[model samples]
Target: MKKHQPAYLKSHSDGTLAKKLAAANARLQHCDLCPRRCLVNRQAGEKGFCGAGADLKISSYNAHFGEEPPISGTHGSGTIFFTGCNLRCVFCQNYPISQLGHGQPFTVRELADIMLELKKRKCHNLNLVTGAIYLPQILSALELAIKEGFDLPLVYNCSGYESLDALELLDGIVDIYLPDAKYNDPRMSKKYSQSADYPEINKLALKEMYRQVGDLILDEEGLAVRGLIIRHLVLPENIAGSEQVLEFIAKEISAQTFLSLMAQYHPAHLASNFPELSRRLTKPEYERVVDKLHELELDNGWCQEL
Candidate 1:
């Protein structure tokens, strides 16, 4: 009602951002920032499972229109694609940027400049993609951006495997959450993403995210201001456990939870090597998930027309 303002403004004014930035930066020493718990001190130049160091590596930043309609809006979501991912999903489409680390290093000041620049382009929100590996740097840059009048909403677009501690730092700093419920089955997650703990971590992460921002809130123009937007990319043969994901959202989280049922699966990266993930999601596989969504009374959100 009172004209939605970005959460960081309050966090910054209350001095919460400073504290969160400090605590997050400290995690680089041991580097348990993600679910990986790769205790290799990233500040000491030790590369962990994510292949990220202290320096922030970003692939690109742009006003993207490829997100959900509410997120993209009339302008676009200011997307900052961070290079390197904590998980190694075999079918990753952005394999070059996420796995092979195709990006250039950026200072916190330069990163802050990018945020201001996006705001100048009238982007709806600052969308941070694959940000788990660079939480500290993002926070530091956000602090700088806030000082320079970056008033846009912040979207944490991440693979669902997250650390609760890392998320705690983002309590009031982030406004919208665009996270994936990538896999529901532990075996499938382990086989594809090499993270046996993805399901458990993703579930817990979603809970925290939902607690922070309850349901998706749209403005007068149907643009998202704050809230969680769950993305479940439909995988070939249901390897992504789509039914279980929808069930969890409907029963555990909320039936009204904003969902973006994705049908854009293609055998990229090392997916060709794995028989289970070697093909695009079939019409049947995607339809089944959509049917289940209706069955579960998930009336809110968008279903891709594939």
Candidate 2:
């Protein structure tokens, strides 16, 4: 069987990657990278809602084995956890990294070196976690990494609140999109994540991701190469609106779409402040969402046991 060549290699070869880098870099001056549309000029050291500046800030980078099977595989996914986030999720597990920004800054060249190092470590894919704010920097680093013969499949792991413009720049570059369909109810989204438009934006982002990658395609080794994987974490007391999220995926996106129905919703960060979100997901709550998944015939995914 022929080896799977990543989409970015072709994009790099055709010079489109350079164009994308240029386009993405231009947005840093008036930053509209995510749905927040915080027009702060990151180039001038202005911080926006995400709290990211000009430099690329990363909390850590390592071969992570905790992702979905295809993503982690036997070798593990090379995960780069970027600092800061557009959405301020009250129950964020990594609030110290995302909200408080506990990370070191790196230039584009250094970031490129990290990507090469991950490739050298024999990672299955380069998993970029919550890097929507650093789109330009990522593109710049990817361009450099490609020059150094880095060719691992790029996994864009992100919250589903994305901008079409930013996603368009990554059209032929990102091989796999791992985005979360966090909430289906605007009120729930607003109260929990501080993003009232999360549901509307998340739906559009999922459609765009599906349009780009179609469905998950695995190799002979059962490892994902190019695809869209939607993760829906079942929040306490149906706060995540899991049923409606499944319905949207089944009806709007293909029923064959790959999903990661997560059940590990433990209260963290500011979750204690909200009574509804102050506890771990009950088994009944999780099973109800699982029932909905089965009823919708969305069988091409993984479900966690509560």
Task: Compare the candidates by TM-score and give the number of the best one.
Answer: 2
- Model 1, 90-122: lDDT tens per residue? 888898999998999999999999999999999
Score every model by TM-score: 0.98, 0.99
After TM-score superposition, the amount by which residue 31's alpha carbon in candidate 2 deviates from its true location, in angstroms, is 0.6
lDDT of each: 0.92, 0.94
- Candidate 1 wrong stretches, greater than 4 Å: none
Cα error, candidate 2, residue 86 (Å): 0.4
lDDT of 2 by residue, 35-128 (tens): 9999999999999999999889999999999999999999999999999999999999999999999999999999999999999999999999
Candidate 1: residue 156 Cα off by (Å)? 0.4
How many clashes (backbone N, Cα, C below 3 Å) per candidate?
0, 0
Q: Where is model 1 poorest over a 10-residue stretch in terms of lDDT?
A: 276-285
RMSD of each: 1.1, 0.7
Backbone clash pairs for candidate 1 read none
Tell me model 2's lDDT, rounded to 2 decimals: 0.94
